[model samples]
Target: MPVSSATSTAESPPAAVPSATVPHSWEYDGTEPFPEKEPAAPRDRGERLYVAVTAAIVLAPFLALGLAGWLLWGRLIHPADIVLALVLYTVTGLGVTVGFHRGLTHGGYRAVRPVRIALAVAGSMSFQGDVIGWVATHRRHHAFTDRPGDPHSPYRYGTHLRGQLRGLLHAHVGWLFRNSRTSAARYAPDLLADRDIRAVSRAFPALCLLTLALPFGLGWAIGGTLVHALTALLWAGLVRIALLHHVTWSVNSLCHVIGDRPFRTRRHDRATNLWPLALLSFGESWHNLHHADPTSARHGVDRGQLDPSAAVIGLLERLGWVSDVRWPTPDRVAARRV
Candidate 1:
């Protein structure tokens, strides 16, 4: 007898299902073929609350110190405190200006091993994170300037006065609290490659403690009193850091928002020359010149600009500590004029 077409088709053992298209038998069994993955959710409000709380922890104490200093009738800060503050301020400021900014960021000058390590340590004592992190953020700042991804730009908010004021605050201190960290891999490859720098970066927290404690220790030795030590710690450590932070932030905020733009830069980049802050900011107030010629070791190119940082670099060069310094040429400066 001839087999019926329908029965023959049905009896063909399901036509030997193709391996590629067939569902795995394990999928239907007790075990799952693929592991289930939990979906990533947005960060909770509690995390944001923690960040705000931590920021207050860092900022509130300094604000109180400033207020107390202002309120106190007698000398809240003595001469010893002032001197110590000035000395440390100058050391750390030079470390950032010369070592981190010029040397690390732009390679404006080369230094010997000892000089490099010393500078990295000095900068670490400033409590501005590791040297690599500082250089990375700063380089990103220059690379993006006032653009969307700029770490701290006064223009990020808007041109309106209120917006600018908010932006100034953000640029000054708020950016530090941000969780979006700069990638050192992309921005600071050179520093990352240096073992000395990596080691110093790892030791940043200890150096910061020493920076604060050294003032108190010195004051105690000099004045032979705990009161003097406290005063010195407040003024030399806390107040000095606060002041430097603002000055540096001002270069990002006020320097971009206001001041004389004598030198031309890329369009919308309003880097300016605020001469009043030259000494206080260790010559960093010459923002226009810096933006114009970033590789030049001296930002205050004009006569009588009073760049103490530049003077320090010059002294270092004369002492054979820093070599191949990139001082600006007259032609280069002229070419940058508006």
Candidate 2:
């Protein structure tokens, strides 16, 4: 439930620095050292099967967009469908941003047992992968960042224009199909050991089904027609998932390559703060600040920067649902500023 900041030396990369503030279980022992060559893509049947399933997950909703657009043209969409879509999008999006990312991955604050489990469940419904795996992959990303060991860095190709273009595509979505796996045992041992979190991770497939079924059930109840249920599934289920998926992925692809870096990060780490994505990403577009100080509960520390995730954390803190929030201090922010 608690993790603190990691320490780094000028010679040591961020990945090698373990947290001094957390117990052994909570500590991220950083993945293998940076500058290691990327693993060769495995060509086994298992890898093929993994890619096939990933294609279904990533492409099915995208194909649904075409159907949804056709339905919209025919005036088949109900306002109830739009409203339901918005509601589910907000819930699942925040679940990924606040729940999977800030709370579970970085340990920005300590939530009560119920809140913690609830957030994990919510994030799981976003179709992002289970809680433990998601946290483990993200921790591995922070460890290696843009270096060779990093899983989804845009710099994986090169700094050249053509390479950057290819990398943007890879970073945005191609990385999901890769068979390179982050070890939950090494990176997220704490979550692996926790009975509650393990249970949530085990329930990821059920949550995926439930995420879609809820909209269908609600639409059936509201509109009382089979057509209504199907439309709701299209709009509120598939379309919403696609929108949130790209937005979250844009943080990995666009945020790194195309935004302002107001905060300094480790060498080769080019994470940036893209303000246009602030609202949609629930303040996670402040990627530069996050790379600078991963443990900070709030990323939009500067004035006029909107961070809805931070607001939620603040509200939870006020209600005593969470505690030990690592809100950025003035000195801390100033020190990291470019």
Candidate 3:
């Protein structure tokens, strides 16, 4: 949900690694008040178009849930639809957690070129955003954290009850509708310079189509009917997207406000470890440790914590698909604990 801010002071945890080898230098204490700003206006035609497209992406899948329920009531959902949805959800969720967030944004591991490209494409298909844009925004989130520059900090509106309520909604989904674009040139220069990642970013629209089409095609082939295909599109395509969208957004909204803060982060950085979301978010809900050590390959470092994304990275590392993985050391974890 966040990243490292300015480097820690003499009293801060020395073991924590800032993302992409950047050093934190911001001097704010945790006591600083959040600076509120006027809402952004979509003044240009392109800005309006951006808002329209974002609305379609965010709302269409959510609306599909009602239709999915209607179809479920009619007993139209087949075993094939369920299977396809599970497969796609797992693939795309890991693509975002393992690929976009940990691997690309934080530089947690060095992946083989092919594996890197494949992960980028898979993450792109998640319909979050283009690979480069997602990385840039996430990096910026880390850089500014809950301060004024954070794109979707729930604390942006201050810590009051009314402001917190409004900020939660803003962080959850309202941020997507705003035209506050994170510049890839400033935040994700590495991705911008990569030829393969650039191509994947440009192919985002095509991949969005492919993500839906694959389920439809598979369902039609397996069930031998247009009805099966349509159901699969509903369940695996739109419904799956909606679930992932809310879960990811929950990390940004709920994780910060609720859950246990086992680790210390920069001033005003209120990341928390939300266990209820751990299974669904593939370990990304271990937000406290993540903000504490942004570059660590593993977020769920405690016993009995389920982290499928970390497991996947471990598997890839063993297979020689990735190296230099910034797995959390026991001493480092202990040092950062509150």
lDDT of each: 0.75, 0.85, 0.86
The sequence of per-residue lDDT tens digits that candidate 3 reaches over residues 212-264 is: 99999999999999998999999999999999999999999999999999999
lDDT rank order: 3, 2, 1
lDDT of 3 at 313: 100
For candidate 3, give the lDDT of residue 109.
87
Error of 1 at 277 (Å): 0.8
lDDT of 2 by residue, 87-179 (tens): 998899888888889888888889999999998898999998999888888888888787665789887777777778878898999889876
Q: Cα deviation in Å at residue 5, candidate 2? A: 9.4
Worst lDDT run of 10 residues, candidate 2, spans: 4-13
Highest-scoring model, lDDT: 3
Candidate 3 Cα outliers beyond 4 Å, as residue runs: 1-42
Give the C-alpha miss distance for residue 73 in model 1, angstroms. 1.8
Worst 10 residues of 1 by lDDT: 1-10
Of 2 and 3, the candidate ahead on lDDT is 3
TM-score of each model, in listed order = 0.83, 0.90, 0.90
